[model samples]
Target: MRLCPAPGGPAPLVVINHGSPARAADRPGLRPAACDSEAVQWFAARGFAVALPLRRGYGASGGDWAEGFGRCPQADFARAGRESARDILAAIEAARRLPAVSGDRPVVVVGQSAGGWGSLALASLNPPGIAAIVNMAGGRGGWAEGAPNTNCRPDLLASAAGEYGRSARVPTLWLYTANDSFFAPAIAQALHAAYTAGGGVAEYRALPGFGEDGHRLFFGRGGSAIWGAELGPWLAARLGRPLASGAAR
Candidate 1:
């Protein structure tokens, strides 16, 4: 886990989650985001103490791989998402216990790729203290067989999203790109339609493509500028004020 504490004594918490690697073998080598990374600094500058948890079964925190969604044709996306959510929820609780993190302010959950899918699952639980979720290119079953835009089972993925939306009342921000190689615009729109149709509260935004693949927009260099413009106002409305200006060192 990597923690970047805000300058203030106690501040709102933001737990950022990493995505699942396309290759199964890469899971063991995954690592948490650096504390001083641009993404973490962005939150820290905004008065949020950031915690990046390396979920179980990934990287140095290896255990049993609990997020497998079974074989492709009939992947159990819901189960896999739930398992991922469990870890994120735990991370939130643990982070809140830190002295630098205030319990009064609501928590913000941010995730990319599979991590974003987990954030959606976490919303269904409506865990207290979680005020909002920011899903950046979130989805599973993407790039099947290493092919761009290929999905393992998009139908099942959409179904799982709807299932989560049935009880997810927390407001969410869904950010995607026009040229995502993993989950294309069409797939992203379908997932959003299913989620909102099932009663999930979400605001969706599709931005212009970035770099080779828009899927990496959340963590890619210079990526923050594009997403931050949209995210800043959205977060201010919920937090009741604007984020602190200037970057945190």
Candidate 2:
């Protein structure tokens, strides 16, 4: 689904990728392709064309869940993430055809959770025209059955971050929360450290704790207020334009 303001001319594009469903059984409901309405409006109102793609194996675009990452104990986080990136890149290519989308303008990729991780992987490729990336609680592993913040292999996840960071050139903004059960501040910090140490240009912000799960921040009703302020300024600086004060609201 692609949403945009009334057409005038080509405008800056925002590729908004969604996260994967928690369970495989949920794929059937994906046919309609769920999205954060507030997020769509938030970016659309700000004079950007937003593209939301329902990747393969989900929604009507069913095929296979290319991003399975193996199973629990030995999950391949990196492989799964890169596979997701492949779909996102394909979406970018399709988005270029939207009449309201400007192919030459700065492209900003925003993703939540698994989607965010995919965005990070995409960064490693340094795709043409992508100006920056915003990762909202980006990570691969989370909530293992009864355990909280217990990923399959934390060390491997950090190493994967370093692996992506090594080839990433685009500046990235990562948002997380102190109380996130998925990737707590400590682990998030470790991953950030590894990524930066590997030469990735990334700015990480650990916001104050949100409700029960900060991982929901990007999709929650008031999520914009938390990420909007920081994002507007970053986009303005990156795209060499001034954004309206309350544009994100």
Which numbered prediction scores highest in TM-score against the true structure? Answer: 1
lDDT of 1 at 108: 97
lDDT of 1 by residue, 81-116 (tens): 899999999999888888989977899999999999
Best by lDDT: 1
- Candidate 1: count the clashes: 0
Q: What is the lDDT of residue 18 in candidate 2?
A: 78
lDDT of 2 by residue, 93-202 (tens): 88887777887787899988888989999999999889899988888777766477666677788888999999999999999988887888988898899899999999
lDDT of each: 0.91, 0.81
Prediction 2 global C-alpha lDDT: 0.81
List the candidate 2 regions with Cα displacement exceeding 4 Å.
5-9, 31-36, 245-249
